[model samples]
Each structure stands twice: as structure tokens, then as C-alpha cells.
Target: MSKLGENLLKISVILMVLLSLFLSWKIWTKPANHQFQDRTDKVKAVIQKKEMTEVYMPTKLFYHHGSGDHFLYTNKESTMKSLHEKIVSLGFGSSKVLSTAEITNLTTKRDLFNLVYPSPIPISLFINMNNVSATLPHDSKNFLFNWLVMSLDDNKLYFVDYKNKTGIEFDIKGNIASIASILDAESNNYVTAILPTDELNYAGIYYLADSTKLKTYSYIIATQSFTTFSRGFFNQPNDLFSNEGENLSLSNSEGESLTIDSKTGEVNYFGKLKQDHSESINELYYETFQYVEDMGSSLGNLRYFSDTGNEVIYRNYVEGFPVFGDNMKGSMAATVQNKNVFIKANQDTLQIPLPSDDSVTLVPTQEVVDSLINKGVDMSKVSDIQIGYKWQQNKETQQAIDLVPSWYVNYDNMWMTQEKLESILVKGGHS
Candidate 1:
């Protein structure tokens, strides 16, 4: 063959070979339906091996333990047990089982992931580790460990850093007022807390790589007024409690209080109080005027008998009682004396007198009257009155009455009823 013909023939053969190679590469790398199915199967195998019976396919796992109860995902007993084991394996120490309610009490939006174990201490200690999944500016290797030290009932989220021995609390915004290091991130210390800006009027969870530095995350829905009768605090946008009219309550380590709202679950008002006050204070204060529903029905005759019973029945109506503090047995009292309502705290017999036709006047000691005057409390304008006190222990029956005063005002004409009077008495001295 001629030289030119030979060269052309070689070039044609090489072109054909290149075309075949390109087609083969595309066929080999393309993903198929079967391949996708195989990947799903692998994931299922791992889940099965872990014995996770209640699997939320698309949901991220949430775990917590508190007040002798353990919770994971939802309030399922089986899932709680599995989570307990997983936490133990992850280096948690001896733990006592806690109820789902208790676990929820320990968690906040910033918590991301947590593992709490029941303890005798007034506050429960749990490993509050930053959830890499929930965090922004994501780093694959950075790990943060924080000790969430909080009272079983207090709304304060205290972040304790054992390594650095320093902490800050994020009140209400991220469960507590402080965020310390429970785990280290990037060999440097990281802290978490809630930061509130007056411009926003809402609090956001912040992560700090070091002192004086911060990275803010999503805004947290503070517990608003009128939604204080439920069992949980700080519901997420996606949480079931986020729905309107979800029974909710506000609480601190010291106590819990109830209120009702017909509006949405988002905390609308920042609460009419100072920033230093605990978040639960608003609920506790509001509860003083609120009546507990079905207390007599739920506890039957036992509701009015025991000291704890009375407190429990009236807790939703009192502001001073700790939501999660020691359950002290006591009696509450309220009365309208003269034009002013007088509330006194003592362990004594409680007697609430009926409304009288004659004008009643509360005669506080001159010292107390002076104090009220200093604080700008207008005694002359105060016509409606309430009183509450703790009953004293009696040696005869081995019983004592601890009275707590709570009262409220009637929306109509502002006629002071005994119920409102009692709540006011408690609210006056407690807040």
C-alpha cells in the first residue's frame, strides 16, 4: 500500500478505539437503580444490627436523660432503653433512668445532643455536646464537650467547662444562662450560650470558639405568656408542642407555674421583667392568678388533704413554689382585710373570710407600709385584696400548714374575688 493510504488507515483505527473507550467509561460509572437499592440496604443492615426498633428514617436522633428518666426521640420505653445503652457506651458514667418529661426538661435548642444520668444532686449533670449535625460552619473533626448543669426544674441552662473551669449561662434562650465546654473543638475550647439583642427582642444560641468571640445560630422561641399549662418548655418549630394550644408551662429549678393562651406557641412578649430574672419567673408570677384545672378531679379527695397535695393542686396558681424544688407540704391562705389585701407567709391555720359589706382595710406593720411606699406601691388605689401563707406544723397531728398567697383581678369591673385576692397576696411577696 502507498505511504499516504497507510497513515490514513492508522488514524481511522485509533479514532474508532477512542470512541469505544469513551462509551465504555460512561456505562461503567453511571449509577443504576440496583446500585441505589444496595446502598439503602447497607444502611438498613447497620440500623438492624444496632437493634434500633423505632427508626425515624429522615429525622435526626435526639437523646437525653434527667430526673431518673431517660428519653430518646419520642417518649417510647423501648427507645429509651436503647439510648441508655448507647450513651453508656459513649463514656457516660453510672446513670439512673429518667422519665421522658425529665429528659425534655434538660434539653434546649442549643443542646443539639445530650446524655443525662440521674443523680442525687439538686441539679442533674449531663454531657452537653455540640451537635455537629445542627451546627453551622461545620467542621468534621471539631468536637465540643459541655456539662449542662441545671436544676431538675430550673429553666437556666448552665454550661460548665471542667477543662477550663469557666462557664456562662444562657437564660431561656438555650436552656440555661451559661454554656461551657463539655467537649473540646479543634483542640481549642468552645462554649455555647444564648445571646439576646434588643433590636431583635428574641434570643439566639451562640457558639464561642474562645472567650469574647461568638457565632450565632437560629433564634429560639422563648416561652411566651398564656401558654403556661403544658408539660414542656421551649418547643421547637417542628416539635409537636409547636402547634397552637399545646398545653405548656414555664418553670425554673425552683418551681413551675401555669398559664393559658389562645394564640400561637411562639413567645411573643419578652416578658415584662428584667433580663437578670430567670425565664420561668414570668410564668411563676402569672400563675399566681391562674386556677389549676381538674386538680380535685385528678387527685380525688386526696387533693386537699396532704401538704404536697395542696401545693400540687395550687402550684399552677402560686409564684414562689419551685417547679422542681423540694416538695414541701403546706397550706395556702388568702384574705381581704380592710381596703387592702394582706398576704403573710407562716405555718398556721388558713382562714379565708367571705366578702363583707363594710370596707375592709389591710393594716400592715408601719415598717412594711413604709417599704411599700418606697417602692411606689400605691396602697390607696389597691381596693381588691388577696392573702396566702404557709401553715405551721402542729405537734398534735404531726401536720403543719404552709400557706402560699396567690391572687388575681377580675377582668370585669375589677371586683376582687377571693381567688384573685389569694393570688395577689402570694404574688406581692414572692416576686
Candidate 2:
């Protein structure tokens, strides 16, 4: 071979060697947070899959006597689930959009009791939750309602899609007398709470008419094994590997990964997911439910909070109020990306309730709002306000958590502690 040709061949070989070395270094130094290395065994924990009816039940229950103030089911454990099941079982005859005149009267009229969800949900899902899987029309599958209203004097039922200021009417299909009795009996269980159906003209927010005290609770927590996540998410758990770090990260060659925080027991998982672009709203919910069911663990009464088009969030509800925090104490979320699914779940969850005497006295809703405004929070910017439990984890141990009663407000679409919102808006507040 010519000398010049030999020189060119050597240069090509050197270039090839350099490319290989660069690739090796990139893989070697990949951040430990998501480094791809070892195999994990299948870890199984028995957490029963919840029925659609249980998780998707209403979050709020209120009764209106028409002439006077309304009453709220103040018992911390929500009575809405039992109510929802009864209503769903009773069935419906027809649905129609509420007339403009009727929609206008929703706030002023006090003759109805309603079950409210945290956000809008399709009517078909409501029906399916009853365990009656019937094919529904496109309208029912897509029509969403924030609350289901039932007439106390009359047996008429309505599903209000608050966003559209429209609603569908349904004839109560079952025994009207039985339904009436149930609502009537609730009078004994409800606390006299004032809903600003007069001035603010909204029925969503409920204010305890008098000073009432709620108890705080501590719970012994239990976390699912890291391997449970790996086995549930990845098709091949044997291919995933983990290291001894503060966070348990399991990865494989197939591009699926799981990261679990050792302290908080929060989990972040990314996996190859195939979703049908044309799937109906009902299908989306069903599939997500299956995914949650597949991943077994100790989930404390997780209830569907909302679906924000981008993601679906389920929160932990205790004694009728939801527990909230950045950590996934009683929460799990599912999001679908292009050809992939990302899930955020918590391994650590509140389990056994510990005996506690801690209790907090919360003022009336009007007072809570007034105080917030006095503290410089712009009430107009506040879209939502309610009471819920704030999860406070014990710093000393990972196995304990405290649920503290606190006020939460949706400020400019962001939900935060009333105190946090106060701090943010204290200086002239946000417009």
C-alpha cells in the first residue's frame, strides 16, 4: 500500500477510537440521579384495587331548605359516597341542558341538596362508577358536571356543568320516596352551615355558622418496597437495577425508569406507554384506573380529585377532608405523554391511626375569608377556598405523619396554604 494511503487509514482508526471513548465516558458519568445500571426483583404488596364508584365519589355534600340557610354534612367523614351510590343505583331517565332561566336560579334557590366533586367529571363516568357498564352516548361521555343537584320537595335531578352555565336533567328512575327519605334523614346528620347563596350567590363554599373544632391526627406510615414500583411499571423488572443512595433509582435498557425518595417515599416513574389518540374520555379514565390498580400498595382512601386535561390527580381523603402537601402522602397522579406514561406515586402512606388528643378550632368561612382579605390577600384572585388537612411528616422518623386542619385557597389557580398565600400577597397583594 502507498505510504500516503497508510497514513489516511491510521487517521480513520484514530477517529473511530475517539468516538468510542466519548460514548463510554458519557455513559460512565451519567448522573447518579438517573444512572442506568442493575436488575431488581419483583416486589409485591397487596393493596386492593378500589372501585370506580369509591374513588370517584363526590367530595362535598350540602342540603338547602329553600326559604332559609343551607346545612353541610360537618362530620369529617364525607357522607357523599353513600349518597352517590344511592343516586347512581336509582338511575336516570333523560338528560337536558338547563335553561338559562333555571341556571340563573341555582344560587338563589335553596330547595335542593347537591353532591359536589372537586372538579368537573363526565356524566358517563358517574354512571359507570355504579358498576353498571353501559354504552353511553357521546354527549354523556363528554358532558361534565361539577355537581349533581336533587330537588328536596320534588324528585327532579340535574347535573350542572358549571363552566357552561348549562346542565342536563334526569328523571329519578328508582323509588322517589326512598330517595326523599335519605335526604330527609340527613337533616339529623348535618350541621347548620351557611352557604353564601345570597350575596356571593355560590353554593360551593360552606361556612360553619358557629365556631367548631376539628381534631388533628397522627398516623403510623408504611411504604411499599421500591421493587413494587419497578415490577409494576416496567415490563421487565429483572432488567432494572438500583444502588444504595438516598433515593432508590431503578433503570433498564428499555428506557423505562423509576426514582423513589428514601425519606419522603415519593416515586417518579417514566415508562414507554402506548395510548390511543382517539380514545374517548371514558376510556382514558378506565385505563388510568387499571394502571393504579396494577401498582399495589397502601393507598389511604385515595379519591379522584380532578383531571386537568394534562394530568389526573387523586388525593387522600380522611374523615371527609383531603390531606394535602408536596409529598405524595395520600396522593397518586398519572400523566400520559407521547408514547410514554409518567406516574407520580408515594410509597409512604398514612396507615394506622395513632391515638391523639390534638384538635384545632377553625373559625367560620366568612371569617376565614375576611381575615385573609385583611391580611392583604386579594379575595377576587382567590378562585376557591376550603378546609383540608395538611400533612406534616415527623422529622424524626419516616413512619409517622400528622394531619393538621388548615385553610386552603386557590389563588390565581394555584392552591396554597392560607398562610402561604398571605405571605405572598401581604404586600399590597396580587391583583
Candidate 3:
């Protein structure tokens, strides 16, 4: 009986050990092929061929920041050689090896001729001659011309005539006669005429107008030409007097004074002045005219003049009416009079007294106090509720401040005003 039992037990133990080893192997060496496949599908769903095409692919443009003239062309060798030749022809020195990323950065800093992809030749050569002119030596005949026959974007082949201060724009549309008439009219006396050029697909001419026999500039931007007007006495005339204009009685630190006329845009100047002045001069401050303007259909022109030193006194006008009126329009009328301050509104008044600090204190209303008492709030334990009200409504310090019991040094010594305490208590429905 004992032998049979021992044999059975030994067989069972061996079988259990074999089963445990198999399970451990399966868990440790299992392939992660399903996990990899799940990740691949997720990436495929998010990345599409069309979306990838929108990304900016590397082009054949190269840049060389070294001392020598070098550039990188297309990704292809044949295309690179052709672009190299074109760059040399454009007076870009010589060509050398450069990286595409470097070329992109250079293009952002300075305009470069964009080349056609797959094609070795540069399709469009862009020259920012406006910025280039600053670096080049100034010459009367210095001009930039584009002989390239191709066109891309808004770029067009044209020649700039810096000698005559004229630009000939090509590929222009519309009737040239109407443009010529408008240019001639606004050409002022400085421009001679706007003639049409004989170039194909191009129209417009550059004419030099007389400006009192003095040479003046006529700026040409695209299809427009701006003729500068010469300075004349009538150009800036004096301003008219008006009410609603700022009272210029205040002393100005700036010496310049303004005179304006509302009937027309006329401005006059009284130059600069100094600061120190006696009572006699101070009395004349009201009579002193700082600035005038006629506020017609517009908000009116404002003139700033100096009464003393270099400080400017701003004066505004209301429909070209002077603020003084026949009489002093109550210029210095005292609207508010208090023990500590006198407030007045005047066109040319100065030196008014400011409100005193701590003039008003916020206190809880009597009603609130009564309610607190009814609520069993110990007056000895509760701090006095002070209500601070600004005597001057315009004062910025009149903001409400919360007065908790902890803010008071002695709860029993709460010294809130009767009026404020009553107001707070009544508003709280306690009184």
C-alpha cells in the first residue's frame, strides 16, 4: 500500500512541474506581432498621401554665406549647372556648393530669383532694386532692368530710369490716354508730362515738370506717380479763434505757439517763449492766444502753442467758435466751495486746491448696527464699521473698503460716524 501511494505522488509532482514550466515559457517569449500591427494601422490612418504632398519639399536652391560667390541649384546636376550660368549672368559673381536650408534662410533675408523645379533654368529673376539701391553707389544713371522674358506672380519685366527719375512699367492694361491725362493733371508744375512708351505690352511715359526751376522728385509706385508740392506761405495758414477751444491760460514749457483759422486750414506760429513771468504777465495769460481752429464738419483742427518755456498748451475749437464769448462765459465760475477745497471750471484758470485726505470715512449705518445687535452680535466683540466716502466725487481714493472686526485695534473703540452707520444699517434692512 505504501509503495503504490509513493509512486502516485511522485508522478503527480513531475506532471505539475512540467505544466508550470510550459506556462512560464509561453508568457516570457510570446511575439508582439499584433501590437506592432495595431501601431502601423494607427499611423496609416492619420497620415494621408494628399496631406503629405502639401508639405514644402526641398527645392534645388542653395546658399553660400562664405566669402566666395557660391550657390546651390536644383536637386539635379543638369538643372544646377543651368541655374549657375544664369546666376553668373546676373552679376552674382560665381557659383559654389551650398545647402538647400541655407538658401531658404538667405531668400527670407534677401529676395532671390525663384527657379522652376525639374527645369535647370531660373524661370523668374526677382530684384528688390528698391532695397538694392541703398547698398549700391549713388549714380544719376543708376537703374535696374529685368531682361528676363518670363513672368510669375506679380513680377513683370521692366526698366527703371533713375537718371530721369522715371519708371517704365510693362504689361500695363487699360487705355493709356486717360492715364496720361490724370498723370499730367496731378503732375503739379514739377512734372513735365506722362508719355506712353513704345515698348510692346507696356504703356506710360516719364516727363520732368518744372518746379520753379528747382529739381524735385516724383515718386512712382507701380501705376501711380506722386508729384510733391513745393512749400508756399498759403499752404499752412493761421487758424481762426473759437469757443470750446482749450483755454490757453496755462503756462506752457514749449516756446512754440499755434494760431488757427476755421474758415480754412490756416495755421500761424508765435515761436517759443521762456517760463518766468510776473503778475502783469500772468494777468495777460487770459488774453494770450495759444491755438485756434474752426471745427466745421470735422472734429476741427487742434493747435498747440507754448505760453512759457517749451511746454505746449493744447487748444480745441467747437465749430470755429471761441470759448471766451462776448463775456467770459463764466470762465472761472466756482461751482463747488468747501472748507478745504474750491472747484472751478474755466478755460484759462489754474492753481485750484485739491481735496484733503481722510476727509471722509465709511461707517456702518445705524440700521445695520441695530440688525447686528438683534442678531446677537456683541458690540464689544464686533469692530466699529467705518464708511469712508470721498468728499470730492472725482477723487480716486473713495473706493469702498471692507472693515472686518479683525481690522480694528479695539472692537469697543469703534468710532464710525453716525450718518454712515445709519446708512449701512438702513440699506441692510436692519433699521
By lDDT, who's the top model here? 2
Question: Which pairs in model 2 have colliding backbones?
Answer: 38-240, 38-241, 39-240, 66-110, 76-319, 77-319, 96-169
Give the residue spans of candidate 3 off by over 4 A.
1-134, 137-253, 269-431
Candidate 3 per-residue C-alpha lDDT over 1-431 given as tens digits, one digit per residue, 9 for 90 to 100: 46677457545544554465466446424342221111333333443232111111112323222233222222233333343333323322122222334322322332222222210111111222111211222341323221111122223222332212333323422233332232223222221211222231021111111111211111110100000000111112222122234221111133323323322212333422222123332222222211111111111112221122212232222211112211111122111112111111111111122222222222223444455566544454442232211111122211111111111111233333344444555666332
Q: TM-score for every candidate vs. truth? A: 0.15, 0.81, 0.15
Model 1 lDDT vs. the true structure?
Answer: 0.25
Candidate 1, which segments miss by more than 4 Å at Cα?
1-25, 28-194, 197-203, 207-431
lDDT of 1 by residue, 173-211 (tens): 231222222221222222222222222211111211122
RMSD of each: 29.9, 15.8, 39.8
Query: Candidate 1 vs candidate 2: which has greater lDDT?
Result: 2
Candidate 2: tens digits of C-alpha lDDT, residues 144-261 = 8887888755566888865456777766666666655666673446777765644342334667787668899877665565656665666656645565576767877788778878
lDDT per model vs. reference: 0.25, 0.68, 0.24
Q: Tell me which of candidates 1 and 3 scores higher on lDDT.
A: 1
